[model samples]
Target: MMKEEVLSVLVSNHFGVLTRVTNLFGRRGFNIKALSVGETENPAFSRITIITEGDEQTLNQIQKQLSKLEDVKKAVIIPDDLLISRELLLIKVSADAENRPQLDALISEYSAKIASQQSDCLTLELTAAPEVLNLFIEKMRSYGIMEMCRTGSAALALGTQTVYHDAK
Candidate 1:
Protein backbone atom coordinates (compact mmCIF):
# COMPACT_ATOMS: atom_id res chain seq x y z
CA MET A 1 0.00 0.00 0.00
CA MET A 2 1.27 3.42 -0.90
CA LYS A 3 1.38 5.89 1.95
CA GLU A 4 2.38 9.51 2.23
CA GLU A 5 5.39 10.22 4.40
CA VAL A 6 7.16 13.38 5.50
CA LEU A 7 10.90 13.32 6.11
CA SER A 8 12.90 15.95 7.95
CA VAL A 9 16.46 16.15 6.80
CA LEU A 10 19.21 18.20 8.45
CA VAL A 11 22.16 18.98 6.20
CA SER A 12 25.13 21.25 5.77
CA ASN A 13 24.14 24.64 4.37
CA HIS A 14 26.25 25.08 1.30
CA PHE A 15 26.04 25.21 -2.44
CA GLY A 16 24.83 22.05 -4.27
CA VAL A 17 23.70 20.44 -1.01
CA LEU A 18 20.06 20.43 -2.09
CA THR A 19 20.89 18.91 -5.46
CA ARG A 20 22.92 16.14 -3.83
CA VAL A 21 20.15 15.39 -1.35
CA THR A 22 17.42 15.33 -3.99
CA ASN A 23 19.59 13.16 -6.21
CA LEU A 24 19.31 10.37 -3.65
CA PHE A 25 15.55 10.34 -4.10
CA GLY A 26 15.91 10.39 -7.88
CA ARG A 27 18.36 7.52 -7.77
CA ARG A 28 15.90 5.48 -5.75
CA GLY A 29 13.10 6.27 -8.23
CA PHE A 30 11.01 8.01 -5.61
CA ASN A 31 9.06 11.09 -6.55
CA ILE A 32 9.04 14.05 -4.20
CA LYS A 33 5.54 15.46 -3.96
CA ALA A 34 6.51 18.52 -1.96
CA LEU A 35 9.82 19.90 -0.76
CA SER A 36 10.76 22.92 1.37
CA VAL A 37 14.30 23.80 2.34
CA GLY A 38 15.77 26.68 4.29
CA GLU A 39 18.58 27.52 6.63
CA THR A 40 18.09 26.66 10.24
CA GLU A 41 18.60 28.90 13.29
CA ASN A 42 22.24 28.09 12.96
CA PRO A 43 23.58 29.57 9.75
CA ALA A 44 25.74 26.57 8.90
CA PHE A 45 22.86 24.06 8.78
CA SER A 46 19.68 23.64 6.79
CA ARG A 47 16.45 21.76 7.25
CA ILE A 48 14.69 20.04 4.35
CA THR A 49 11.16 18.78 4.65
CA ILE A 50 10.15 16.33 1.94
CA ILE A 51 6.79 14.78 1.21
CA THR A 52 6.68 11.57 -0.81
CA GLU A 53 4.46 8.56 -1.40
CA GLY A 54 5.80 5.03 -1.14
CA ASP A 55 5.29 1.69 0.54
CA GLU A 56 6.98 1.06 3.88
CA GLN A 57 10.10 -0.70 2.63
CA THR A 58 10.85 1.78 -0.13
CA LEU A 59 10.39 4.68 2.21
CA ASN A 60 12.78 3.11 4.65
CA GLN A 61 15.33 2.64 1.89
CA ILE A 62 15.07 6.28 0.91
CA GLN A 63 15.58 7.36 4.51
CA LYS A 64 18.67 5.18 4.79
CA GLN A 65 20.07 6.59 1.57
CA LEU A 66 19.57 10.13 2.76
CA SER A 67 21.47 9.43 5.96
CA LYS A 68 24.44 8.10 4.01
CA LEU A 69 24.95 11.26 2.01
CA GLU A 70 28.00 13.34 2.92
CA ASP A 71 26.00 16.46 3.64
CA VAL A 72 23.10 14.82 5.42
CA LYS A 73 23.32 15.04 9.19
CA LYS A 74 20.10 13.29 9.98
CA ALA A 75 16.97 12.01 8.21
CA VAL A 76 13.83 10.95 10.03
CA ILE A 77 10.17 10.39 9.18
CA ILE A 78 7.64 12.62 10.91
CA PRO A 79 4.28 11.11 11.73
CA ASP A 80 1.28 12.88 10.29
CA ASP A 81 -0.53 13.27 13.59
CA LEU A 82 2.55 14.88 15.10
CA LEU A 83 3.32 17.15 12.18
CA ILE A 84 2.29 20.79 11.67
CA SER A 85 2.44 21.78 8.00
CA ARG A 86 1.43 24.74 5.91
CA GLU A 87 1.85 26.12 2.41
CA LEU A 88 1.42 29.54 0.88
CA LEU A 89 -0.93 30.06 -2.08
CA LEU A 90 -1.06 33.22 -4.19
CA ILE A 91 -3.82 33.28 -6.76
CA LYS A 92 -5.13 35.88 -9.14
CA VAL A 93 -8.79 35.39 -9.89
CA SER A 94 -11.10 37.18 -12.30
CA ALA A 95 -13.19 39.87 -10.66
CA ASP A 96 -15.47 42.67 -11.70
CA ALA A 97 -18.43 44.52 -10.35
CA GLU A 98 -20.60 41.46 -10.95
CA ASN A 99 -18.40 38.96 -9.16
CA ARG A 100 -16.38 41.11 -6.79
CA PRO A 101 -18.84 40.79 -3.95
CA GLN A 102 -18.95 37.00 -4.29
CA LEU A 103 -15.18 36.81 -4.34
CA ASP A 104 -15.05 38.97 -1.23
CA ALA A 105 -17.32 36.48 0.49
CA LEU A 106 -14.98 33.64 -0.37
CA ILE A 107 -11.98 35.62 0.83
CA SER A 108 -13.72 36.25 4.13
CA GLU A 109 -14.81 32.63 4.43
CA TYR A 110 -11.29 31.31 4.00
CA SER A 111 -9.58 34.15 5.88
CA ALA A 112 -7.59 34.84 2.72
CA LYS A 113 -6.09 38.27 2.26
CA ILE A 114 -6.37 40.55 -0.71
CA ALA A 115 -2.72 40.93 -1.56
CA SER A 116 -3.41 43.17 -4.49
CA GLN A 117 -6.25 44.27 -6.72
CA GLN A 118 -6.61 45.56 -10.23
CA SER A 119 -9.56 46.65 -12.32
CA ASP A 120 -10.09 43.13 -13.66
CA CYS A 121 -8.72 40.79 -10.98
CA LEU A 122 -7.88 40.30 -7.33
CA THR A 123 -4.71 38.64 -6.09
CA LEU A 124 -5.25 36.65 -2.94
CA GLU A 125 -2.78 35.34 -0.41
CA LEU A 126 -3.54 32.33 1.72
CA THR A 127 -1.38 30.27 4.01
CA ALA A 128 -3.03 27.07 5.09
CA ALA A 129 -2.86 23.32 5.09
CA PRO A 130 -2.29 21.73 1.71
CA GLU A 131 -5.76 20.19 1.59
CA VAL A 132 -7.37 23.52 2.44
CA LEU A 133 -5.40 25.20 -0.31
CA ASN A 134 -6.53 22.52 -2.75
CA LEU A 135 -10.16 23.13 -1.81
CA PHE A 136 -9.68 26.86 -2.22
CA ILE A 137 -8.31 26.32 -5.71
CA GLU A 138 -11.35 24.24 -6.60
CA LYS A 139 -13.64 26.98 -5.31
CA MET A 140 -11.82 29.59 -7.38
CA ARG A 141 -12.02 27.62 -10.62
CA SER A 142 -15.57 28.77 -11.34
CA TYR A 143 -14.48 32.35 -10.84
CA GLY A 144 -11.68 31.84 -13.37
CA ILE A 145 -8.14 31.69 -12.13
CA MET A 146 -5.87 33.96 -14.10
CA GLU A 147 -2.70 32.59 -12.50
CA MET A 148 -1.49 31.05 -9.24
CA CYS A 149 1.67 30.08 -7.42
CA ARG A 150 1.88 27.91 -4.34
CA THR A 151 4.81 26.92 -2.21
CA GLY A 152 5.60 23.40 -1.13
CA SER A 153 4.75 22.19 2.34
CA ALA A 154 6.86 23.60 5.13
CA ALA A 155 6.51 21.56 8.31
CA LEU A 156 7.78 20.86 11.75
CA ALA A 157 6.93 18.37 14.45
CA LEU A 158 4.42 19.53 16.99
CA GLY A 159 5.30 20.09 20.68
CA THR A 160 8.70 19.03 21.96
CA GLN A 161 10.18 17.27 18.95
CA THR A 162 13.02 19.08 17.21
CA VAL A 163 14.56 17.98 13.90
CA TYR A 164 17.91 19.54 14.73
CA HIS A 165 18.32 18.68 18.37
CA ASP A 166 21.98 17.77 18.01
CA ALA A 167 23.16 20.15 15.30
CA LYS A 168 26.30 22.11 16.10
Candidate 2:
Protein backbone atom coordinates (compact mmCIF):
# COMPACT_ATOMS: atom_id res chain seq x y z
CA MET A 1 0.00 0.00 0.00
CA MET A 2 1.16 3.53 -0.71
CA LYS A 3 1.76 5.66 2.38
CA GLU A 4 2.10 9.42 2.65
CA GLU A 5 5.33 10.45 4.34
CA VAL A 6 6.62 13.75 5.57
CA LEU A 7 10.37 14.36 5.50
CA SER A 8 11.83 17.28 7.39
CA VAL A 9 15.26 18.42 6.27
CA LEU A 10 17.67 20.88 7.86
CA VAL A 11 20.07 22.50 5.42
CA SER A 12 22.34 25.48 4.96
CA ASN A 13 20.52 28.62 3.97
CA HIS A 14 22.30 29.21 0.67
CA PHE A 15 21.50 29.81 -2.94
CA GLY A 16 20.60 26.85 -5.19
CA VAL A 17 20.02 24.52 -2.25
CA LEU A 18 16.33 24.18 -3.01
CA THR A 19 16.96 23.42 -6.66
CA ARG A 20 19.42 20.68 -5.80
CA VAL A 21 17.01 19.09 -3.36
CA THR A 22 14.11 19.12 -5.79
CA ASN A 23 16.26 17.90 -8.63
CA LEU A 24 17.21 14.90 -6.52
CA PHE A 25 13.60 13.92 -6.23
CA GLY A 26 12.99 14.31 -9.96
CA ARG A 27 15.98 12.20 -10.88
CA ARG A 28 14.65 9.39 -8.70
CA GLY A 29 11.19 9.49 -10.33
CA PHE A 30 9.52 10.47 -7.06
CA ASN A 31 6.60 12.85 -7.22
CA ILE A 32 6.53 15.47 -4.50
CA LYS A 33 2.97 15.99 -3.29
CA ALA A 34 3.79 19.14 -1.37
CA LEU A 35 6.89 21.13 -0.43
CA SER A 36 7.50 24.04 1.96
CA VAL A 37 10.80 25.72 2.83
CA GLY A 38 11.73 28.63 5.07
CA GLU A 39 14.53 29.96 7.17
CA THR A 40 14.92 28.32 10.55
CA GLU A 41 15.21 30.08 13.92
CA ASN A 42 18.91 30.34 13.21
CA PRO A 43 19.30 32.42 10.06
CA ALA A 44 22.15 30.28 8.79
CA PHE A 45 19.91 27.28 8.22
CA SER A 46 16.53 26.50 6.68
CA ARG A 47 13.91 23.84 7.26
CA ILE A 48 12.30 21.99 4.38
CA THR A 49 9.13 19.97 4.72
CA ILE A 50 8.33 17.58 1.88
CA ILE A 51 5.25 15.40 1.47
CA THR A 52 5.36 12.39 -0.84
CA GLU A 53 3.64 9.10 -1.43
CA GLY A 54 5.42 5.80 -1.86
CA ASP A 55 6.07 2.40 -0.35
CA GLU A 56 8.30 1.94 2.69
CA GLN A 57 11.39 1.09 0.67
CA THR A 58 10.95 4.11 -1.59
CA LEU A 59 10.56 6.42 1.36
CA ASN A 60 13.71 5.08 2.97
CA GLN A 61 15.65 5.58 -0.23
CA ILE A 62 14.43 9.15 -0.59
CA GLN A 63 15.50 9.95 2.97
CA LYS A 64 18.94 8.44 2.37
CA GLN A 65 19.37 10.41 -0.84
CA LEU A 66 18.36 13.68 0.79
CA SER A 67 20.91 13.17 3.55
CA LYS A 68 23.64 12.70 0.95
CA LEU A 69 23.22 16.22 -0.43
CA GLU A 70 26.02 18.59 0.43
CA ASP A 71 23.83 21.33 1.89
CA VAL A 72 21.54 18.95 3.79
CA LYS A 73 22.56 18.64 7.42
CA LYS A 74 19.80 16.35 8.63
CA ALA A 75 16.86 14.51 7.08
CA VAL A 76 14.30 12.44 8.90
CA ILE A 77 10.79 11.16 8.36
CA ILE A 78 8.45 12.65 10.94
CA PRO A 79 5.90 10.11 12.04
CA ASP A 80 2.30 11.23 11.52
CA ASP A 81 1.51 10.85 15.23
CA LEU A 82 4.36 13.21 16.09
CA LEU A 83 3.72 15.77 13.38
CA ILE A 84 1.80 19.02 13.62
CA SER A 85 1.03 20.52 10.23
CA ARG A 86 -0.99 23.29 8.62
CA GLU A 87 -1.59 24.87 5.23
CA LEU A 88 -2.82 28.29 4.11
CA LEU A 89 -5.59 28.73 1.55
CA LEU A 90 -6.99 31.80 -0.14
CA ILE A 91 -10.16 31.32 -2.17
CA LYS A 92 -12.28 33.71 -4.15
CA VAL A 93 -15.89 32.77 -4.66
CA SER A 94 -18.78 34.39 -6.48
CA ALA A 95 -21.06 36.25 -4.10
CA ASP A 96 -24.14 38.39 -4.58
CA ALA A 97 -26.96 39.57 -2.33
CA GLU A 98 -28.93 36.37 -2.66
CA ASN A 99 -26.20 33.91 -1.58
CA ARG A 100 -24.05 36.22 0.55
CA PRO A 101 -25.80 35.26 3.77
CA GLN A 102 -25.37 31.56 3.19
CA LEU A 103 -21.73 32.05 2.20
CA ASP A 104 -21.11 34.07 5.35
CA ALA A 105 -22.54 31.29 7.46
CA LEU A 106 -20.37 28.71 5.76
CA ILE A 107 -17.28 30.87 6.23
CA SER A 108 -18.12 31.28 9.90
CA GLU A 109 -18.52 27.56 10.30
CA TYR A 110 -15.04 27.00 8.87
CA SER A 111 -13.55 29.91 10.81
CA ALA A 112 -12.33 31.46 7.56
CA LYS A 113 -11.35 35.11 7.64
CA ILE A 114 -12.87 37.60 5.27
CA ALA A 115 -9.96 38.91 3.28
CA SER A 116 -11.97 41.05 0.97
CA GLN A 117 -15.37 41.42 -0.66
CA GLN A 118 -16.78 42.93 -3.81
CA SER A 119 -20.17 43.17 -5.47
CA ASP A 120 -19.33 40.09 -7.53
CA CYS A 121 -16.95 38.07 -5.37
CA LEU A 122 -15.60 37.46 -1.88
CA THR A 123 -12.10 36.34 -0.99
CA LEU A 124 -11.62 34.28 2.15
CA GLU A 125 -8.48 33.11 3.88
CA LEU A 126 -8.11 29.94 5.92
CA THR A 127 -5.26 28.28 7.72
CA ALA A 128 -5.89 24.70 8.76
CA ALA A 129 -4.98 21.10 8.23
CA PRO A 130 -4.84 19.83 4.62
CA GLU A 131 -7.99 17.75 4.99
CA VAL A 132 -9.97 20.64 6.43
CA LEU A 133 -8.85 22.91 3.61
CA ASN A 134 -9.82 20.27 1.06
CA LEU A 135 -13.34 20.11 2.50
CA PHE A 136 -13.60 23.87 2.51
CA ILE A 137 -12.59 23.97 -1.14
CA GLU A 138 -15.32 21.48 -2.01
CA LYS A 139 -17.90 23.56 -0.13
CA MET A 140 -16.89 26.66 -2.03
CA ARG A 141 -17.31 24.90 -5.36
CA SER A 142 -21.09 25.11 -4.96
CA TYR A 143 -20.79 28.90 -4.62
CA GLY A 144 -18.86 29.14 -7.89
CA ILE A 145 -15.14 29.53 -7.26
CA MET A 146 -13.31 32.26 -9.13
CA GLU A 147 -9.80 31.37 -8.05
CA MET A 148 -7.76 29.86 -5.19
CA CYS A 149 -4.22 29.40 -3.98
CA ARG A 150 -2.98 26.87 -1.42
CA THR A 151 0.44 26.78 0.14
CA GLY A 152 2.39 23.64 0.75
CA SER A 153 2.14 22.10 4.19
CA ALA A 154 4.47 23.35 6.90
CA ALA A 155 5.06 21.14 9.92
CA LEU A 156 6.94 20.64 13.13
CA ALA A 157 7.50 17.64 15.33
CA LEU A 158 5.47 17.44 18.53
CA GLY A 159 7.14 18.29 21.85
CA THR A 160 10.94 18.25 22.05
CA GLN A 161 11.55 16.20 18.93
CA THR A 162 13.19 18.25 16.18
CA VAL A 163 15.27 17.90 13.03
CA TYR A 164 18.51 19.77 13.42
CA HIS A 165 22.14 19.76 12.38
CA ASP A 166 24.79 18.42 14.74
CA ALA A 167 28.16 19.74 13.58
CA LYS A 168 30.12 18.52 16.56
Tens digit per residue, CA lDDT, model 2, 1-107: 78998888898999999999999999999879999999988999998899999998899999889889999999888898998889999999999999999998989
Error of 2 at 8 (Å): 1.1
Per-residue lDDT over 34-147 for candidate 1, one digit per residue giving the tens place of the 0 to 100 score: 999988898989989899999999899988889888899988898988988899999999999999988999999999999999999999999999989999999999999999
For every model shown, the clashing-pair count is 0, 0
Q: Once model 1 is optimally superposed onto the true structure by TM-score, how far is the C-alpha of residue 95 displaced, in angstroms?
A: 0.9
By TM-score, the best candidate is 2
TM-score of 1: 0.95
